[model samples]
Target: MSKIAFIFPGQGAQYVGMGKEIAMEHKSAQDIFEKANESLGFDIKKMCFEGPEEELVKTEYTQPAILTTSIAILSVIQQNGIEADITAGLSLGEYSALVYAGALKFEDAVKLVNKRGKYMQEAVPLGKGNMAAIIGLDRKEVDSIIKEAQDVGTVEGANYNCPGQIVISGEINAVEKACELAKEKGAKKAVLLPVSAPFHCSLLKPAGERLSEKMESLNIGSLQRKVISNVTGDYIANEKDIKDLLIKQVSKSVLWQDSIELMLDGGYDTFIEIGPGKTLTAFTKKTARKLKKKVKCYNVENTKTLNKLLTELG
Candidate 1:
């Protein structure tokens, strides 16, 4: 049986004015933004709808901003009767996925990510850490490059995004060295990402520890639907494992390619990305093509894209 997987994008996917149209058109979407404001005790909707870009991009603000926008869009998706057989997210996006799966409450998730963002940012001092995307290099090649770079400083593969794209993160000098090595190894491109912190690397382990402490106090519910974990790239069979998985995810490599492959192998042929940008959707396409898998991928961040996807799905 063909199934649908709802994928959510992580931190870097946020932007000003994301989900504005949908929030304006759909009451459910608007209610999410309102709820975020009430829960957060600030007007995140204003920042998202009219960002100064600087404020919206800060790791502290960016986490909840992206989460709220993604959930708002998710509300719209659910309102339209679109649902997922399984769900997964990249990095911070995992919280959104859990919330959608009924394993985490939206209010708790919003607050948790706020703290998570703050902790992650504090893990590494500004300008001391960096991340770079290596294109046209397989995971093994990128791993090798990161290992070689570790000779200079701490560098590790942070995200295995797809067949030919991997993100490495760690010390600034080490990341730069890795990028140079990746280019020398004939990678198509090795570009530094405009991110605030070196996320998903050992350098951020302190942040993970802190997040684990925070998670211990929260109440996680039973899953309404299976949600793939980024750390394991497998289905989380028990709700008891959610907290530990989320904590480990903070400082572990995001096995996005593996997660997508797992879904594909499980007969999920359609993917709908419910979030701010189309980054996850794009990655889905690349992963599907590389694996020679036929799948339909769509992103719903606005009314037009939502309508188009609804039509296609119908």
Candidate 2:
């Protein structure tokens, strides 16, 4: 009676040659990549398989790249007769989860994410917004630090990654001030992240507003599987709320920890991270440990991981 969930990674997980192997080996995976290339009107396949590294890192490029690779891998997994009972993703990955749950078409999701990336990148001026990871601090401690740091600039929690790890984002001065305060208050590490913009913070509210307008022209369908929302960290109760929650998700802290807890409590014991890097896998294990729950983790970026998954699960 082990239920499984398919989770996806968000931005910052892309690397050169993410989906090359699978695309070369599996027609299903290759088709997904082809569809993405056609959908975006650019050679995303080249950027992913043989990246210049510079173009791949741009926020406008990064979001759809990761989504394309993730969906390609998901196609291969499904072709092998593997599936998940539920789905969720972190930040940008939520759109991929919606696609897996039949709430979105891949073509539409790709176009939407492309617009989303551009909007977010343009929301804040470069070098003005910043993000930092505060390790070894509890939620309340991070909250206190953020509130205290606001005197210096606007700072707020970005992602509640796990019990002892949190990411803060906002104006550069405020984020730096929060990092200094976190270290002084016994944080193990407060490291600045190399990201383009201050994502998942109040500073990006304008990006959410832009996304709302873009989504107005898009169509939403019925869900085929249960999917969780990054804004609520709970089952999306109504499809009508998807647009609103996604808009709020851009400016609010991503409730990744809560999403994992909800799945764990619902008896989802196996998690398959269907994406490039193992970021979501690590987060899931950390969250499970904090709640004294046991779970299995797997990721499929290339043929090797995919084979391992088939051997163990198939």
Candidate 3:
């Protein structure tokens, strides 16, 4: 029998009015938003529903908003009897996965992620660090390009998103140089990402350090379900490992492609992306095609989409 895995997307997936439909239509969803506001001590729902786009995009607000929205949607799905056998998320999404797995409480995850976002945003000065996407380049070639640009600064592969799409992050100069080198190495295209910080790179070490200290003060628990780590592409089974990996994940490359493969290898053929955007679903389809695997992927952003997914899965 095929098992279902619920995945969540990270920072770049958020948009204005992402969770408004659910909050407006479902009491459970509305309760979630209200709880998030209470737990966070602010009106996160307003920022998510009526964002100026710029304010919503701020890292601090973005992380909690996405987490709350995903958990709210998950609440709705669970009410309807749709459950996940395993859970995983990418980067910021990992917090959502932990909350779903019961390793972290929703309220604590919200506060922690808010701090995480703030620390990450403050890690590097504006314009000092950057990120870029190199499309149509194999991992080896992308790695080579990043290595070649290391002399300019500390360029490194950050997000292994799909078979031929990788994101690199580092010093702004190094990232720009890497993009040029990627084009020369026959990448289909290399473009700078519109992000504020060089996430998932060595430049984020300070942020990781801060997060580690903050995490030490929190009460983390054992997971109710399996959760794959983005740092190692492995299932984290212990609380110690979870804390360690979460800290390291800030400056470590996100092995998203490997995590997906690991899940596929473990008998999860259906992946349900429970978040605002279909970004992960799109990437999963590409990866599945490249690996010649017959996996079904779905993205449920609202009740209508959730209903469709349940019907299709049935």
* Top-scoring candidate (TM-score): 2
Give the Cα error of residue 307 in candidate 1, in Å: 0.9
Per-residue lDDT for 290 in model 2?
88
Query: Where in model 2 is the C-alpha error above 4 Å?
Result: none
Shift of residue 250 alpha carbon in model 1, Å: 0.9
TM-score of each: 0.98, 0.99, 0.98
Model 1, 1-314: lDDT tens digits are 55899999998888899979999999999999999999999999999999989999989899999999999988877877888869999999999999999988999999999999999999999999999999998888888888889999999889999889899999999999999999999999999998888999999999999999998789999999999999999999999999999999999999999999999888789999988889888888898898788998888889899899878774
Residues 250-295, model 2: lDDT tens digits: 8999999999999999999999999899988999999999889999
Best by lDDT: 2
Ranking by lDDT: 2, 1, 3
Give one digit per residue, the lDDT tens place, for model 3 in 55-109.
9999999999999999998888888888886888999999999999988999999
Error of 3 at 68 (Å): 0.7
